[model samples]
Target: MTTEEQTAVHAAMVAAGADRRPGGRTRTFHALLEGWGVEVAGVEEGYAWCGPEFDNDISCRSTLADVWPLLPPRVRSARQPRLDELDERFRAATIEWPGRGDEEQWWMWRIPRLLVIEPGDPYEGGWPAGWTMMPFPKPDSVRVIT
Candidate 1:
């Protein structure tokens, strides 16, 4: 990724409190793992450490698991870090995000797993609103196009 793209993503991560020292420095998922005290360095073994249940669940797919090693181990484990570890918030995007109905389904964007960031209350029928990349966002969550 370009430095500009990295800065933008890191800025968003910082704004979301996922990453703190978010200026000029390079940002990658490995950096997050470093903060977690996981020895991710020299892990050229690819997804071997990811193990079996990595993405076996039907809700998740093998293709998604392809990016597993690229993400931080904590994110890979999908859990909260120790108090001394980085103060980052993670939701299953389904288990943690707000939704309704007997359905275990959540709709973000992916076809199988719909854990996307929609506007307003989920019960109110927020959805995959149309959007295109832009320089800035509007004030209202619905009207603001990314």
Candidate 2:
């Protein structure tokens, strides 16, 4: 994340009293952010995002949902509604498709899904070879995927 973004996240966490909370709660919040592809560090200086640029991915929906109730009312009121709106749009653009045979279902979003292939992976021979493209479902409203 950019220094500005890291500062912003750190400020938000501090404003939410993350540093004052029990260690477990702070750790849980840190883990959630990390799972969202954010690099978290500086626990003693208060939590900060030290990762690559923040993409504000759909994964943030779960993070917000899980942490909403734990935040101070002021923080929740300041941020949750806007995040909820964005999450709704993301959900509308996403489809949960059942997997073939015994595999579990997975979510497919309207945007292109990035697949990170390791050097020895079977699909590493060519880019886009391993991808399964799907047509987006017809939206009932103009707001979907807008």
Candidate 3:
């Protein structure tokens, strides 16, 4: 975490009265970020991407409002910004999949079963030899990693 993020975290803790007495969830999240070499946090659940930075302090399922207060200046926005060319007005805000096409999304969503990310190529590694190439799933649940 950058100095800014650290400060934000501290302020959030104080404001929320988070228990930061060591070995807590917040500490754990910080440890993960340290281990992952995430320098610039990106697209947090609440805050917009603070420009391709790494963040372990927040995750998906986090309410946009609750974490909004802790967001750094870089990501704070008065209105939610439209990412890429996603037209929220024309598209349903959420999508679900049963590994099959849904008629409801045929015209509204860029849909069907989507492979969220296609790696440049599949990875082939075993433990310490190529750990960085491991197929890692980023934090997805609402629970904070820290």
Per-model C-alpha RMSD: 17.2, 13.1, 13.8
The reply for model 3, stretches above 4 Å from the true place, is 1-5, 17-23, 27-60, 75-146
Q: Which ten residues in a row have the lowest lDDT in candidate 1?
A: 40-49
Best by TM-score: 2
lDDT winner: 2
Q: Which ten residues in a row have the lowest lDDT in candidate 2?
A: 42-51
Q: TM-scores of the models, in the given order?
A: 0.21, 0.32, 0.24
Model 2 residue runs over 4 Å out of place are 1-57, 99-128, 132-146
**Model 3 per-residue lDDT tens digits across residues 1-146:** 56877677557545543423245545322332232222112221222212112122222112233444665655444223522122232123222222333553222212211112223423232112212332433212211111
- Per-candidate clashes come to 5, 2, 8
Q: What lDDT tens digits, residue by residue, belong to model 2 across residues 27-146?
A: 334444444332111111222221121123334434445455665555556655655554444434332332322332121223322233344544322322233232333223211110
> In model 1, what is the error at residue 73, expressed in angstroms?
19
Clash pairs detected, candidate 1: 106-114, 107-114, 108-114, 108-115, 108-116
